[model samples]
Target: MESPITPFEPAIADEAIADLQQRLKLTRYPDEETVEDWSQGIPLAYVRELTDYWSAEYDMGRVCGTLNQWPNFLTEIEGLDIHFIYQRSPHSDATPLLLTHGWPGSVLEFRHVIDRLSNPTEYGGRAENAFHVVAPALPGYGFSAKPRAPGTTVQKIADLWIALMKRLGHERFLAHGGDWGSLVTQAVAVAPGTTCAGIHITLPVVAPDPETLESLLPEEVQALEAFNFYQDWDSGYSKQQSTRPQTLGYGLADSPTGQMAWIIEKYAQWCDCEVNGLRHPENAIPRDELLDTVMLYWLTNSGASSARLYWESFNNPDMAEIELSSAISLFPNEIFRSSERWARKKFLNLHYFNDKIAKGGHFSALEVPDLLTQELWQWREQLRALEIVA
Candidate 1:
């Protein structure tokens, strides 16, 4: 018999909170970057400021309160207790949708839009757009059980998600995700005998077929350049996580400042933040919201275990062709973008592809929740139209 799903309330022990504060108070400062700007990873000054704020001003109670507002739960799936937030829509026939978060993110990423998506009419949206939303914390991340051994790859997570939805009484569901979650979503969509009705991925992991590369359009060429740039300059973290996560995890696990710097640096680099302009990711995303994500990793001691996923499946050679109906929402500053022609090579039944989103980046769900929510609603409408035609 499957383990019963139990109500979950996240609570960090007072001792842990006290330990975090003490660690922050005793943070050893690194020498300042030689040159100006974030060219040399996270600048010491910025990290210090953020760490100071996190230690002094941020309230863990408030963060916990925000999280508890949602209906959270835990259920055993494949010997792991999966943690998730399941919000049923007021509409009786609302579509069931699974939203997954990626690395450097948590279920907190979807908090802003869950209510809007679930209760559309209350949020100036049509009731027809309402959805019963479920956002799961990937294994070894958030409150989910950490794997003691290996083999929890994206493919495995996909299988767990299918079981999760079924256990929640959703025999069929829609799926959406970005980053690692996107990989899991694709896996779920392509798996044999999957009940995923449709999927909308912010970052579909599709690549150009080498044979068709010679006839690329200008936009396709630009997308390739972006991909190359990421491989060259921006993938150092991935490399470390994939090759020696245990080594890197020592520092991250021991030091709260180390954890904050590691994650905040990504928000600076990966979000649609203007370096010398009026808009910064810190401005686009509230400081408190960013710290809330950092706390999840720090409190759970997930710095190492989360990075282990990269080690397990970063280069897994299992990109099955997807025949399920799908949609892609391309953000402007996404590390890499694949043109429709290239994407079609893998997404055999690509029903909706939009590369014109004006803003946001890798963390679009957090940085631009309104726009992301709108795009998802629009994509759902497109899927509905296709179903009508069928």
Candidate 2:
């Protein structure tokens, strides 16, 4: 017999909201950064402004209402209750698509494009292009229940996701992901048990083979340089999360300001902000949308649990090579960019590859939903064509 699935609507107690306000009011800020720019991390002034807005102006009710607008549910899967937003397209034959979010993100990242992808005809597209969307919060992120013990690796999450789709009555589906989610999606595609048709990812994590390193193309060299720069500068959070998430989680769990800064800093650095000549992420993504994501982490107290994923599967050796039908949409402002030559080495059955997304960054769905939506639709057609030929 199948485990029962229950409809769920998240509700934080009044006491919890009151306590958050009291903590925000009592926040003790650190000294201002010696540097003027974000190079030293989120500046004191920027954090202050965000916290002030959060404590005084931001409305939690609005965020909750937006979330409740969707059909949310929880189902027991592999000894844990999984939270997800499952929206079936009106068209009976709509393709089933599973969207997995990464660190510092929740199902909210796909909020803007969910309706459009599920009902393309309403948005100037064909009904045949519509998709039945299933976006699940990772085991320790958003509304999903956090694992008490260790061993919730990306591979394990992929296995759980396949089970989830099967339980929902989908035997085959397409998957898309970004950031750490890309790792999970790739795992799903390659897993022997998965009935996945194909996979799409915003960034394809591929490193040049040592044998091919001697004759690097100009773009490949640039990609390597970009990766190095990320390792040197932007990777402090990853290292810390992977090494000591418990220690780091204390501050994040105790202080909303700390949590906001920790997450917002990534948006400023990883999004299309620099291209738009904006110093902060709010200039690219709406402030409320950003805060909505932060609220998920804060309410669930998932700061540490979410970070544990890095410890479990960051740079796992098994992910280095994948031989499956794959598509990659390369956003220019993304931290790491893999050239077609480099990606082809691993994704041997690369059906679609486009590296010239004029806008967006690491958070392609949130930063450039329209472009990502279009790419997913186009890639679906390409994947179908390949299946026919095969």
Off by over 4 Å in 1: 275-279, 388-390
Where model 2 places Cα greater than 4 Å from the true spot, the runs are 275-278, 315-317, 388-390
The digit string of per-residue lDDT tens for model 2 on 1-390 reads 678878999778788789888888888999999988888999999888888898999897665677787889999888889999998899877999999999888888898889989999888777877899999999989789889899899889999999999999889889999987888899998888789888999877887767778898787888889899899999999999988889999999999889989999999999888644447797679998899888878877889989988888884646466777899999988888888887888898898999877898888898888898889888987876777211
For residues 1-390, write the lDDT of model 1, one tens digit per residue.
988999999888999999999999999998999977777888887888888898889986666787899999999999999999999999876899999998888899898899989998887787888899999999999899999898999889999999999999998899999988898899889777889998889886766779877788887888889888889888899999999999999999999999988998888888998856633558668888989989989999999999998998997736678889988999998877888888898889999999998889989988898899999889878877877211
Lowest lDDT sum, 10 consecutive residues, model 2, at 381-390
69 Cα displacement, candidate 1 (Å): 1.0
How accurate locally is residue 148 in candidate 2, as Cα lDDT from 0 to 100?
Answer: 88
Residue 196, model 2: lDDT of 88
TM-score, each model? 0.97, 0.96
Screening candidate 1 with a backbone cut-off below 3 angstroms (N, C-alpha, C), the clashing residue pairs are none
